[model samples]
Target: MRALIIDDSRAIRMILGKTLRGIGFEVFEAGNGCEALERLQEIGRADLALVDWNMPEMNGYDFVCSVRSKAEHADMRVMMVTTEAEITQMIKALEAGANEYIIKPFSKEAVVEKIQILGLIP
Candidate 1:
């Protein structure tokens, strides 16, 4: 499977990329939502997108909404990997079309579990 990790922080991207790749995914990355969109146009939609909430250009919420609005990307799995812990924010993300949520400062196991819950892995 292919996964895209979109975040403003390179370290966070690297960490998530490593974790996903370890779990048998081919990883791609973007600095923010806009870049992620551009990448989607370039390389096509990924099996999953690990998106961060606060980012430069377009934020994760808007990104999720945009992706969900497009028919081509509708089937793509989006998991919000963010620091936003409030229930309202979580609901907003879900409403915007996130398939799952994972708070930051997360363990690799946590990420893997979410992917499994998404049924991207068995």
Candidate 2:
């Protein structure tokens, strides 16, 4: 499987890369929503994306909205992997078409669990 990891932190991206690869996923990364969009445009779609909530230039919610607006990208799995755990924020993410939400500071095991729950892994 393939995944696109979007976050402002290169360290987070590296961590996700290591974890995802261990789970048998080939991972790509973008530092923010704008970069994610560019990656999507240049190299085709990924099976899933782990998007960060707070980012410079276009944030996660807007990114999800953009993805949903494109019929071709309608089925891409989008998970909000963020620090914001507020119920209202969760609702907004879902409303914007996120397939799942994962709070930050979670373990690698937790990340894997959520990915499995989203059917990104077996």
Candidate 3:
């Protein structure tokens, strides 16, 4: 399987990439939403995307909206990975078409379990 991880922090990205790779996914990464979008355009499709809620340009909210706006990517699986702890923010992400979320400081097991529960990974 293939997945895309969008995050501004190199540390977070590396952690996520390593975790997903261990789960048998071929991972692609981007520093922010725009770069993620660019990668999407070039790569055609990603089986799943792990997106951070905050970033320098085009936060995950905007990225979700953008992805939903496009017919080609309308069904993309987008999961918010962030420090945003508000229930309202989680609702907003879902409203914007995110498939799931992983809160910040989450353990690798939690992340993996959520992805599995969301049916993104086997």
Candidate 4:
């Protein structure tokens, strides 16, 4: 599977990339939503995207909306991996087309569980 890790922090991208790679995914990365969009254009499509909420250029919520608006990216799964912990924020993300949401400072197990829940892994 192909996965994209979208975050402003390089360390977070590396960590998520490592985890996804361990799970047999080929990972790509972007520093923020705009960059992620550009990367998506270049890479064609990603099976999954792990998005961070607060980012320069464009935020994760808007990214989810943008992706969902496009027909070609309709089947791509977006998971918000963010620091936003409010129920309202989570709901907003889901309504904006996120498949799942995971709070920051998360364990690898949590991420894996969510991926499995998304049906990305068995």
Candidate 5:
């Protein structure tokens, strides 16, 4: 499977990338939502995208909306991996088209479990 990790922090991207790679996913990364969109354009599409909420140019919520708006990327799964832990924030992300949500400082097991629950992996 192919996965994209979008976060402003390079460390977070690296950590997520490592976890996804360990789980047999080919991972790509972007520093923010705008960069993620550009990367998606270049790569065509990814099976999954793990997005961060607060970003420089564009946020994760807007990114999910943008991806959902496009027919070409309709099958792609978006998971918000963010620091925002409020119920309202989670609802907003889900309503915006996110398939899953993960709060920051997460365990690697949690990430894998979420992906498994999404049926992206066994």
Candidate 6:
């Protein structure tokens, strides 16, 4: 499986990358939404995207909307991984086409369980 992690924080990206790799995913990293879009264009496709809500250039909501607008990425799974912990934010993310939402400070087990629940992992 493949995963794209988009975050402005290098540390968060590194942590998520390591965790996803440990769970048998080939991971790609991007500093922000624009970089993530470029990376996706270059790589062709990703099975999943772990997007951060607050970022430079573009934000996670816009990114999700952009990806959702594309037919080629119709099946791409987007999971919002951020510090935004509000019902409104979560609703917006889901409405914008995110498949899941994981707040910051999440545990590796939590992430794995989410992937499993999404049936991205067997």
Instruction: Report the number of the highest-lDDT candidate.
Output: 4
Show the lowest summed lDDT stretch of 10 residues, model 2.
113-122
Evaluated at residue 62, the lDDT of candidate 2 is 92
| lDDT score of residue 45 within candidate 1 | 70
Candidate 6 is scored at a TM of: 0.98
What alpha-carbon RMSD in Å does predicted model 4 have with respect to the real structure?
Answer: 0.5
Q: Give the TM-score of candidate 4.
A: 0.99
TM per candidate: 0.98, 0.96, 0.96, 0.99, 0.98, 0.98
Quickly count the clashes in candidate 3: 0
Enumerate clash totals for all models, in the order shown.
Answer: 0, 0, 0, 0, 0, 0
Q: What is the lDDT of every predicted structure here?
A: 0.93, 0.91, 0.91, 0.96, 0.94, 0.94
lDDT of 5 by residue, 26-93 (tens): 99999988999999999998999999999999999999999999999999989999999999999989
In model 3, how large is the Cα lDDT of residue 57? 83
Model 5 lDDT at residue 6 = 95
Pitting candidate 2 against candidate 6, the one with the higher TM-score is: 6
lDDT of 3 at 3: 91
lDDT of 5 at 95: 90
Q: Residue-wise lDDT of candidate 3 within 1-122, one digit each (tens)? A: 78999999999999999999999998999999999999999899988899998998889899999999999986667899999989999999999899988889899999899888878767
Residue 15 of model 4: what lDDT? 91
Per-residue accuracy of model 1 over 6-99 as CA lDDT, tens digit each:
9999999999999998989999999999999999998877999999999999999999998998999888999999999999999999988999
lDDT of candidate model 5 versus the reference: 0.94
In model 5, state the lDDT of residue 1: 80
Candidate 1 segments whose C-alpha is farther than 4 A from its true place: none
lDDT rank, highest first? 4, 5, 6, 1, 2, 3
Model 2 lDDT tens row, 26-47: 8999999999999998768789
Q: Candidate 6: where is the Cα deviation over 4 Å?
A: none
Instruction: Give the worst 10-residue stretch by lDDT in candidate 1.
Output: 37-46
